[model samples]
Target: MTRKRPLKQAFALLVVLSIFMVGFRLIPFDEPRISLGNYTIEDGFQLRVIASESLLKAPVSMDFDDKGRMWVVEMIGYMPNLEGIGEEEPTGKISILEDADKDGVADHAKVFLDKLVLPRGVAHVYGGLLYIDGPKLWFVEIKNDRPGKKTLVDPVYAEGGNVEHSSNGLMMNIDNWIYNANYNFRYQLKNGKWLKEPTSARGQWGITKDNFGRLYYNNNSTNLQGDYVLPNKIIRNKYFKPSIAENKRLGANRVYPIHQTSVNRGYQSGVLDEKGFLKDVTAACGPLVYRGGIFPESYNQNAFVCVPEANLIKRNVLHYKGLQITASQAIEGKEFIASTDEGFRPVNLFNGPDGAMYVVDMHRGIIQHKAYISQYLTEQLAGKKLDTLQNAGRILKVTSKTIKPNPIPDLSKASSSQLVALLSHSNGWLRDRAQQLLIQKKDRSVIHQLIKLTSLTNSFSTAIHALYVLDGLNALSFESLSALVNQSKNPETIAHAVGLLERFSARQHVAKMKAISTQLLAQNNETIDLYLSMSLSPWLNLSEATFLPVLSEIEKKHASQGIFQEAITSGLGGKEEVYLTSMNPTDLLKKDLTTAITNRQKKELNPIFVLEKNSVDNRTKGLKLFRSICATCHGADGKGIQDLAPPLKGSEYIDGSMKRLASIILHGVSGPIHVNGKLYQLNNEMPALINNKEISDQDIADIIRFTQNAFAKAGKGISADDVKKMRDKKPSGSGIFTEKQLLESDFEK
Candidate 1:
């Protein structure tokens, strides 16, 4: 009996050991564990991990639905390792994160959509979810967290660009239009149909808007770039690209990292400080104008920028004057949020429904795209074993220490009247979401309440939201707008009302508008005058004699301000010749205005030629390559990014000789080169493409054809054989060609 008992005990022990080994094998070996204590935020603020690995991975962008649930875009395939192998695999996904327990942390994650390739942007708009997957923008109705009735909003939405330079930030503005960065188009869904229109090409990564509806974005180097004026205001004459208002750099490129930073170009002189910290922003992106009311009043409207390469977030205080906006760094030699943890990559920022600033941390060591990867960066990444950090991401919530965040409200279930009432909410996210819902529902039942809300002079933001909502619903009437124009003491309200009054600029309302214009001219407010000048086009179309004098007066009063002159020019539209002919030639602004008007008219008459079908195909392919590869330094418009490449549009190198251009493309050019008479002394040499096996000779020819057609006088055909000859005649010692050498080369023959 004793021997039998011992045998049974031995069998039981074996079973227990087997169970232990099996359970241990199920543990995740590769998942990286992050410590929240590694972060260092500014005083009076706290950062907490709301979601992390196992719940989400490699989140680049996110949007909140009407229910306050977060829909995150996971770019899982982005730089999975140092080699970036298998990046083309469809591993990206859009996930719905919910804090069902309400403990201020996201514990439940559901894959809303999967099998996406490098999905970059997402927005909840027009009773559907809009998302960008690679080159296409798609709209899918979300039925019970599942996709239904998928629609292609745009096929070439963000085509040809690698993830670094692709269009992102699917932000829905208060003007009822969807805008993106790195692309030159805006989208809208009006009455069950999609409308797409050309807008000024904006920043490289994330995009945002202020409470007043002016867009704000940034590139890789500049900290902040925003429009001084509102949307579609200055772009009236497509030929005249105004430089004062749109895409203006608002802040300096200075950055302050708390620790020694790891940057892609740290080896480059002036990129790193003496202390080995990032001296300036090398990867400044994802700018957000904070309107979350949870912070102190001084924090309102301040711009917070994400600098992932330095592992920091910067704060810029925005100063608003009469008609200008400028931003300065909030603290000297410090950052808003900094971390010693090199893996903390804050790629994007957002305003949460609960009045907190939510940060999307990609949590990967390699933030630089493979296309732009430098040898110095590759070595630095390898030495630190940083390239091994992948498949980890987190969503962090930042809130003020003194103020507690309120519970997020589920506006998806709110009635129309209830939604209208929330338009005045102190939280900008709530107000924006409320207005969006009201417009999407198209419920005119609350139009009367919205009209009443527009009259609330005490709540300027609420009044603005109400006015735009009314405009979106097509409920705005001439009577209500004119009343607001005449009675509202707020300059911003009056400006918006005047701009909206253009919809009512008919012969019957001419006299009333004329009277209102005269009354507004008497006020002498620059803000009101600017919008008045913009809104007078239709009235000028009807009675140029009466409205032209009003525009002239505005021009003469604010003649020193270029924005006002542009506004007046925008108001003239097709009648620029009449205004110029009537104005005195001796007027100080007349010469510049006449030049602008003449250039615009010239462009309108001589439009770009339509290429042949075959030529068009090649040009299209070239454009894709240019945007993906060259647009990083040379802007998408060929107008060169500041501190990077020189403008390619009117360069002598582009227009001089086709063979010289081809040689420069085959073997790159180093500059102190004069491009359009401006000397560009760039820090880094343009890397030679002769050794890049991925780019074929035909690809080089296509690029040449594109630059010639788009920027030169006409397209000059350069066959693949021509490019091959240029490649074969590689300069001795295999170095980039200097401008002197290029100018003296026989390739021009």
Candidate 2:
């Protein structure tokens, strides 16, 4: 090859880039411009284009203000100058669109800010617009009919790398916390003081919440990853990540990633097969939990996602088992919305003002960027003639055909009490706006009324929102907390109360939480117990002696029951060890519960039966014992009978923490309980089996071995020595063992 000059090569590249940009700008958007008529949707719904074409270029995300003005984020630089340039080119813009004359479609549009490079997330905050423009976040101060003054906000996601998958789904939740998925930073801005907390990265993209204030998150390839036990517990614990422990199973192929659709070329493309499916998800993005009004009541709080690779929006029915999530398809044989148009790419989804879900379609011909472009994908695009429909894009709302959308709220001038009333509104947008304004105004004037709303309102969501607003204003007093725990039975609300008490750490407040926790624990409320443990885990800050009663009650159950058994047992190593350790509890904690239990066992169990060679076939003998003893309560198969007995099958206690399970069998159990997410009253308490004579250690081991083999399919059989080691601690004199005691046995160790 003739050696080309370095300068000449550089010139050729620039010329090619210039031609590509020119072609992108000149590409025709079909005449009569694409509208709602261009697409088809599911039954019981109609698609209406709110804004299109010139008003929106490559719109990816959107949000609305109190005035119902729609703010749309457009990534014009997406796919990088139509695949001929670098990724970070500062080509993103925020468009403010409005139907000034009250028409349904947007008739007025203005470029609020046009300097953003790959701006991905947008939300209405404090009467202004907050958006993520790369790694840095920005806020634009807006006054109607004028250009907004954009200011550098928090230094959240420093804004580099692949723009396609970055932090997104910016939102303020019921707890008055702002979060973005794929990022660990959480924000709580109170009167200009940003209280930042490092949290778990929810997922790769979308974020949402249910009526109970539990957050749910999603990413592009992963299905779903939240249903947090509390509003923001994961943030405090630092245990969540992009690859969360819990996930919703969407029918997706499990590959690394599908699209290197931006100039950031870190992802692979040859990973895809000939048929071109995204493996597990074609791209599960923009997850929304419908908390809107326009849809039928049946659709409320149901999750919807944009599976772009499949050219469809899917509806998922979410089932929560305690803290875990189980999602099933709400619509069978079809998605919530799908289209034949090859360029129909539903990139992001949101539930907006009029109680309708809006889908943002990038509407591009060549979506996959040039850097990682592969031969197979190139051929696939050529076959579909989907190379460059560059200028077309849309924001369309999907709503019921018969039910008219509620008129948007006009809270720009509402009084404090009026805003408080809006907290109970059916629309998530309205509730969020109401809380945002209340925080901004910080009107101490409504504190009393807000307190009343929290206590008197029938709507649990409203009650919780009211308390959150009170907290925002620093107006949450001891009285407000007293009302929250007393007025609501909802676990999420109780969790928030426990969290607040923990943060404040007042002796009186901790005492109050302990009191409430005592009652809730009696009912086997897992949410409250979990929250209480999280609050108390910091140090021996609050004297471990204070919770002795609650601790003593749960000691027999599971350690997860909020009774820290290892801490308790190690403390019991003797009065001197306890006295020495009060000043340095972390040191005492080093003495594992197993060692403590072993020490205590030699002193506790009377007439322990050493296993004999002729002790009987465990499965056969254990089954006979189970039929005569446990069958009445735990059922024939250990699946549990009803309110009277709890199931042993499928319990984490059975397959997990073998020591905990063996202890419960040896000592018997009492108090309220949680088994596989269901709560039981235990009206007929599980009778203690080890009367020192009726059930021997060998018999106990055999029974458990049989129960494990019969009920827990994934169980490893319990050995005779395992039962005696757990039996070292004597049973309580009367009543039954609590969940905490079983967990304290250190079986999970």
Candidate 3:
């Protein structure tokens, strides 16, 4: 009996040990959900409605006041009478909603402001709310219990002094001065008005102010701008990689705009006057040139910094007050939440009450889908119990309480052993956080620790997080990544490690990425799934030029996968002209140009050209047409880039249908349209493209076909019959087309 009892105890112990070992895979490894203890999570987190909500019909941007009340900007036309208000452009008005009970749902909802003239960007300055209405800068001050709006700048001045009235992005510095991004408006704003400020770059939707008062705007281009004073001193480096710049380019893939950081002094300037109020245009960063880069290695100080898309949430060094200022990775990471939020399109970073940054994604998408808004509001109002990932597009609170970022350890004073001990801590967050801090502190002595962390199989996930830290730290080296890949046995871990490598110049990591990819492919382990090939193409490997044929075949085979297909198509779409032997890059570039030119043309012309010819023809005629007609609204190259004018090329709408096209040109699209899968509001008043009785139906049809085939290859070879059908049975001018409506249209076929 004693011997049997001992055997049973041994068997029970083995069973318990087996169960515990299997539980590691089930551990909740998601980013920690922490609470500040004082301001509950409900205080900041907002509910989003991307999938439902009818009244919120195309919510684009949102703004908040000192009282914490929110004003949502809806893209669809307003229901003034709620009985029969005809749909019209400038479908403009503002909704004021309040959550007095601390619930995410609004306790009170009504139209707070109305009759806005195509308002795009909104911000708060001093005690009033500011909005960009056409060429005028207007503000409404809240007094007693009512709101009153006043024009801060004259419409004529803003229009005549500048290129156009539309403004896409806006921001207010801590000192209270406002900066506006005039979708392709590279002009100057002087004395409460705008003027021609010529530059090679076009401004897109992002504008932010750094602590030093430098205003950074996302210039929608890869072509570097030439120096104003020293015209010949043009920097060859691309500041904003076009593939990553502007919402339209990236929106197609469901990715937001490139995250960028800039100083306020770069574009406009402000200072606290004697009255302690903010004033505009005090100084520019032009004269404050630094020789090195933005951080430790190169601090080249020049006026008007152009931030690339990759550095968003990545650590960057900026020159402020003649001192190289260091911004922590946490500051950059805040944008991830703001970027993910749907309501906050055209988001601008603002200092919140908690002394941290809060971004209000313009309520463009929110207003478009009211059902989603209702459900989202319901979930949010319910204390965020419905913590679904789809609600990423909400009002994100970046208070210090949300993210308990580790304090930066002064590695300069710490011993190597201490550094390793900190990095190898049992807490994964602590260990990863320490590795990031060490990279930033940049003490080479810690290299041994980094190398050791790379080799430890238990630290594979820890090492992946550390690589992103290295990327922000600018400590990523080809040799280092190669060493890590050699030791890595886990496929998922290695996939993340490969993703970081894609950020560097393609030429630099090609060899290492190729070798790692080759090794990953050979692994037959069922648990070893590789997502890295999604970012890989045959062209990535530089050293093995002889293996190009094999790689090309491999790329062709993998191109069928969703991720890989998207990556390759997006990459090709980004190029000005990409040439593959099987299919010429020139042909694709020409097709894009023809699509761009015809989409902008008042009347379609069959220019007897292929992609190569169209590219040449567009360089001449396209620029003129763009400036005279399209530039005033959509901007050159059909980015529909204005705060008011809708983007045409790459526009999901223009890629199909002649009905919406005819309405926009003849009657005009009044509200928001989902283009590139992101909703955009043209704000009504597009100055009717046709004098209804003048243009012939045939001409319109030709124009329709040309535009349909211009931007996306999927839209090629559309027929005029399609145009006639759209023009005949189009929706009444009651509201802009809905995503459901567009999807339901026969044109989708």
Candidate 4:
């Protein structure tokens, strides 16, 4: 429904309170205030104030509707109080803005959804705007190009634990999966059922994928990270262990500092250090992998990450070695879009219709949260403040000479065939919207043609879109999926097909699916093999030999890999040659193809992809070792068993150099133990977990690194040499070292 609230509603909520919810209050005002930012750009680019600070206030996110008009989310009341509380009031708004004159600036604006609470993320999808407002996730349907009634689709449980780090970015991937940041459990209504993929913990606040479906994201801190190697084959993330490592800072190759800006609040960024050395990236948001038609072809898949604290957008060029992933700077010294407007806070980035980059500028006095407020920020805000412009925001468009956006398409009443053609459109969003609309229509008349597009289309992405559309409509068949698998050369197709095809497994299409899995067995994707084994084994009458390949791959994968080990513990059964359940792989199968797969995996994959892949094998081996040995004492969760062993978490002693840390694992701890400022004495003394003959140096290193990844909260991983040094310096023994003996060593100091 349309909100008829007057403009005063945006300005009237400035009253101050003593609560710690709001960090800043709106300045006393009687009239609307606007602060049109100085839109400046570097060479080869043109900047436009699409909707200046006048029309859009606190525009944190935006997406184009079918008609091409932009729908914007205004967090008008966010951060005004101590808590940034939007507690049951019209503190935020979703508005529709139109560039009716075909000019850069929007001439009209109207309230779409009023009275929102910290509404951080939104996208034009399915039928309306999908948004996350802290605890509630909603869909506000658009009818006849206007906002209709809203329905609560799910609850975003990001109400606590740093709301800024909560589920924020809502993006629809090319494969038809709408992913979110941080929120592990999400609901999507599909085929009259709620399909859910819930993880254990949380991840970043912004998420985007490259052309091949490799995800890229960042938190309020951690810069750029996601699949360096081909990720696990099945659904693996049960929890998001936050990367607090100051050293594990991974980003573009080029190391550039914050660009020109005036409102210099924020502490020295985590992406760089005191000596101008790169440390990590903090406040990294709006992760965008450029996939539009208008820009230069050379910039096709370049990743643009917004560093609002730096007042710049970084351009990261993607490079692949063997299969290892690397993102280096596109430029040497400058940012993609550096501005002097310190108040120009870009919270989100979008690849728009005109083949241009859209920046959502929350032009306010403060961007950092109260809890994370640094001393530098407090002093800066005190001097260089935008107190009068607390409700100001802008949507900026960046384009080049070769790019131009077309008029918006009115697809609400488009024909089935008309919608089908968009499957091959150059713009990914167009293809996604078309597929969504066709599925929503659910007309059997278009089924044959939709199936035809999947076969006839030459573009792999277009074909995949058609495949998922059919799946979304719950009309995908074994034949259609089989055709996709047979025709497409991209391994990603096989992976996507497996996900879509598994929906039929519940219907007991065992043989049809078994044939498909039998073919995929030859194609050695760990994730694909894992999925096929799990899906087909429970239904098909396949022999244990069928899963041997997957089981071998699982055996070689890192311990932090997947549900395989857990499956082996819970469902697997066998006397000598064991398997997960009906389809678990045999031990003999691991031996037969173990060395062969490892050899082929190194050479056949990209030349640069070997190291990262090998590390996975090493880590997995260590996990197996850890379970058989260390898990008995440190406990599976690493919190440690009561009295039996002290907690491994928050152990400052463990944070010392690798030599000392490795010595503890190799020789074991003894006497009184103080970790994270607490003392504990176990009943039994520590014992050496490793036997030098059985465990390799790489195995010990991988185990230590895995623990560091899990319990130590470290980014800098140790090498085998680091572990080797500990063994060489202090030979392993059954006797435990006293607390003073471990601490007094000058090795770490």
Candidate 5:
């Protein structure tokens, strides 16, 4: 009986232990078990996790609302596993994270929206939430943290492309226009109407702006690229593509990762240094020009770029010389923030309302999209078990150690007068938000205050913001703008005033504009000169005799400068020939300008597929496919990006045999191939479209036809039958062809 009692007791203890173990596994731990010790930030700056898993999962981008709550876009379905099998599942969400207990860390998370496929961007604008859900940009009013009155802002906002190459960044600039990266159009909701206009297509992943409103963005390889001039300023002429202003690579690609990085192209020579650290930026994105005031004054205007593949954030010190903006590494061989943990993937950066920098860390193992993932990276990910890290993210706040981040103000409840006063706040984010709120309120009572603020000489950024605010409010007049132009000593303020004066460039305003132009031209200030040159076009359209002399004087003085010349040419627009005829024929600068303008005009006139009806139909279909798919890598103009793809505009491959081109397209080509005599050793393998079940034989044919017609200038195109034949002839094994193999194969059939 005693032996039997001992056995019963043992069995009871085992049963209890089993139940507890099962309960422990079933109990949900919203907070992920991640260690903060994994991070290593630069001295004088501290980084702490403010929001993490359970609160926000796979946060790619985040925007703070007027209540100072974070509206986070979680791309949860991205790269779910090594094969990305369930990535199409609509499991993504936008969660509103709040610090409920008044603690710095987010204690509660309420989902504002869910069932998103891959929502990339979000912004609090127009008293509503603007967010990107896959290809569409949507707006929804928030009532009690729930979406209401949903409206589709743009159905094809991003169109077809992988998340990495699709349009994102719903950033509202100081000009009251909402801009995006990887998109050609800017959006605005004016007087309860949605307005979109074509602008320059910018960077790949993320976009930001400086204090002066010049945008900054980056791509996979380049560290930083920015517009020298303000948005839509230089793209005035449909024919001219300004080289000096838009999409200028302002920083070098050199990178210094603290630890050995698991880059996609690590197998390629020169991708990693001798010490095994990434040699350069391979996946640079989310460039943020630091306008947060909490950082040391030296850190002001510093550009912080996210290199997720390297698990680091690079700091770049930007130097402004007149209109040109350039950047250099803050430290020669170090990073601002680095982590030993491979899952510390910082994908986007934002200046917080609290005057600190917030990093949106998609704390996942695989940062690269499956479409561009390399076999070497696949092996690396598998070897390290990085594919197992999923559904986890962190929003890290970076603040100076000596100076605490300011408490986030509830701008939603702030009065109109208070919002107006905030225009001069040291933090650019607050200043921008204040301007946006003021415009949204449509409070005409503050217009006088804003106009007065524009004339303040002490705060140039404030003045600029105030000027744009007045413009946004539709309160700016010729008298007000001219006053700023005449009274303002700050070149940037005067430059903006000059840009604003274009609205008043009628015959009545021309004489006054010419007088202002003549007076400003005498100063020879490059910034003032550039804006004056760009703005004079409207006046010139009305009275060429009055503005022509003004242009000629500015042109002769600044003829050697390309930016100035470009601006002058931009202003001339339809009067290019007139200006060229007036200039000296012997002038080399004039000859160069004439050549550029003439070539651009010719290219515009000689657009692809002005042929027969059938060819035109094929060309049209092909062009749509090319823009949606091929343009992601080859670029819209077919001039490929560095370390991304070789230029297809004049590629020997495109101009060569149709069969060869078809084969290459069906089964992708690996590079170290020569395009226009320049060797391009691209890191990512050109993916095979044969496996993409969505792309049909006809689609492939159209793409080929488009590439040949548009880029190669070939009159002929292949048929779906030809594409099928090439698909059938695809070589055995992995099916991805190397440059050597493609060159050696006989495609004569």
Candidate 6:
């Protein structure tokens, strides 16, 4: 009887195991749910992702346009949570997807932006679309309903550094004042359309405006978990009016500041629940003014409820300026959506015509709709801003205020004082502005100040401006500028000043240019050499005779550094010159010593040695032959690499020569011949002159001798008599040659 009871229990356990297995297959593990008070939501609000892949794979902010088209802004590459596996991110792109039929799946997608440098923020404004372009914000406005040209707004806002370096938000106010939210706050005044504060103002990220004309924004400096950092406070904002006329009457009036409270702070600070989990608590600013200025004067306020990060949508309305206390209400139960999905994560939010608040859910593949009791909040703010602008002009209440104009004397009228004041301004920018005004001043008193400004500061922009003024006054002299160049540390500034002196008929700057070159040689750093070389390249046009000496000096000092090699290669007008000149190959070849040839080869094969033995000399006949016969394709440097010519380095014909070289020169070999592994079809009429009716084999051998030992190889020389023996050899076209050919050639066997 006991055995029968055991068998029955085992059978029951098997039935329970099978049921649990089926449930596991139906649910994905990461999609956890959130719960509210008495109401339980069952994943209906969860994003209906089309693929099995996780939506947060490359999580970033998203945006939506007026057409309701959703765009997801993702940073490039996978975000690895583990150590040592971090890989470079692929180029980032902004994906614009549309769901025309309201189905959960995306209908079509187009690349809205590409090749962005870590671009994170995307805002869709009514005037045109704006995007985060590396370090700058660019907006493209469509023309005549067609996609329009892009305009660069202010490139950097100095909120915590350059706006380009920080991931912040751009929010538009009711008066069209664009408020830039970094970790700090900066606003554009509606009247001037300029920054309310300088680049120094910083604080907060993510910006939104309430309908009643109050500004709302948040700080991202606070937050925890993961390697990623996020601002702590859910929201922070300021209340400011944008009417210029009204603002003149009131001294910073109608501007107030506000902050949002979190759910964790409201409950369960000291007590732990019996279930080992705290009960659901929620908080988010509610009645947020979408545009500031749409309600009755007193109640025309709106607030952004800080939705608790705890997974539930908590709504609460706090006092506008004072942040007075108030009870919060729950909008949506947590279980309705994925707990990891933050609904308000995307920066853009607006109250729609359907009377429901629309939040852009970038990764979710849909626009989320929230029907709540606080929908009136946005409507009130928008109405309030409109009323303020309309009533601004009627109320002209003037207040006492004064602004000091820049101390630089206006150069438009005063000839002497304007020039002196501008040249004396403490900053380089002011000095430059003054120089321009002096161009029309025709004043002599400012010349000393201009020279002083040039000597005291090496600012390239200011020096150039001062040089122009000197030129106008006929005060520029080689002696004066050379003294300044000697003191200037910035090579570019010195170069520009010298150029001015050279153009002003200063013979002294010419010698100064050479002196500068000498000074450049003393610097050991490659950056200094690169800078000096680039600065001197322009002088090459002065006179090849003058330029050649400098080029030789550069080659002498830095040839071992590779700067000389670039200078040689870049200086050659044609390959023929490169082939014939005696560039310093010894220093370059010494590093790769194994490949360097012995002294015996150099002595025996010197163009002079080969010329005397073979009856062809490179100095006279070889140079004339090069220009007439080889210059067309080989260039002056004999580098031999033209659009059609191949480099002669390691060329088999030159290295193995006499018989092989003579046959091709005599018979004009055609068809595919590989040079450096690249095949090319030669011209059929390649005029050859081995021992042909045209010339003797002796001249041909000496010419080949000159080329073989030149440039990179400095190879062994061939005799003219050796070439005469192979005078009648076949073309040897259309086949790869073997070393045995040299042994079997008539010149050998």
Clashes of each: 0, 25, 71, 33, 0, 64
lDDT of 1 by residue, 124-145 (tens): 9888899988778999998867
lDDT of each: 0.81, 0.63, 0.38, 0.60, 0.81, 0.38
Residues 597-617, model 6: lDDT tens digits: 232234322121122111222
Candidates in order, TM-scores: namely 0.80, 0.66, 0.32, 0.65, 0.80, 0.30
For each candidate, C-alpha RMSD in Å?
Answer: 11.3, 23.2, 23.9, 14.4, 11.5, 31.1
lDDT of 2 by residue, 467-489 (tens): 78878888766655766776666
Residue lDDT tens for model 5, 52-77: 88777899999999888888899999
Q: Candidate 2: misplaced stretches above 4 Å? A: 1-38, 80-87, 145-150, 234-280, 369-373, 456-460, 508-511, 538-540, 548-749
**TM-score for candidate 4:** 0.65
- Worst lDDT run of 10 residues, candidate 3, spans 227-236
Q: What is the C-alpha local distance difference test score of candidate 3?
A: 0.38
Q: Model 3: how far is 259 from its true place, Å?
A: 18
Off by over 4 Å in 6: 1-59, 76-90, 102-105, 142-148, 157-167, 183-203, 220-309, 319-355, 359-749
Clashes of 3: 71
State which candidate, 3 or 4, has the greater TM-score. Answer: 4
